[model samples]
Target: TILLGITKASLATDSFLSAASFQETARVLTDAAIEGKQDSLAGLKENVIIGKLIPAATGLPRYRQLTVAVEGYKAREVDELDIAAS
Candidate 1:
């Protein structure tokens, strides 16, 4: 049936996306290890392996970016900046 075919296609697409995500994460971790840099961003597996907080249902401090407040400066809206042409 057409419905079954659609379901199969959806499952295959989900599997492919999952595999690609895993591959990318693995590549990043490998590169970090080679460079002797510690990946402080903890995820499920990493937290479990290190026996720390799993970043869920915890009162941990969230990551924040340091921003500087500029005065008397008008920022231009650049919604269509093309980097490829530069």
Candidate 2:
């Protein structure tokens, strides 16, 4: 997971700084998740929560931080960081 995260961060900081849009980012991420390139959106810890709503942490890292709350434990936070890190 960390690998993918680094790659994505690298891409954003080094290449897509001027061209990447949130919509585009979301689309790519979602597509990757749906396409099996990613394991699951349930692993990115930086944004995931097992039982709470992931607050809007603004800025670049937000796109990589994909948080998700578990079905039963909606109050806890789960970081699905493994989804795309590597």
- lDDT of all predictions: 0.43, 0.41
Cα lDDT tens digits, model 2, 7-78, are 465444322321133326666556555766522223223234332223343323465455666688656433
**lDDT per residue as tens, model 1, 1-86:** 45545444443332333222444556555655676765454455455454555565431434122234579877543221221122
Question: Each prediction's TM-score against the native?
Answer: 0.29, 0.19
Compared with the true structure, the alpha-carbon lDDT of candidate 1 equals: 0.43
For each of the candidates, give the backbone clash count.
Answer: 0, 25
Q: Global lDDT for candidate 2?
A: 0.41
> What's the residue-level lDDT of 68 in candidate 1?
41
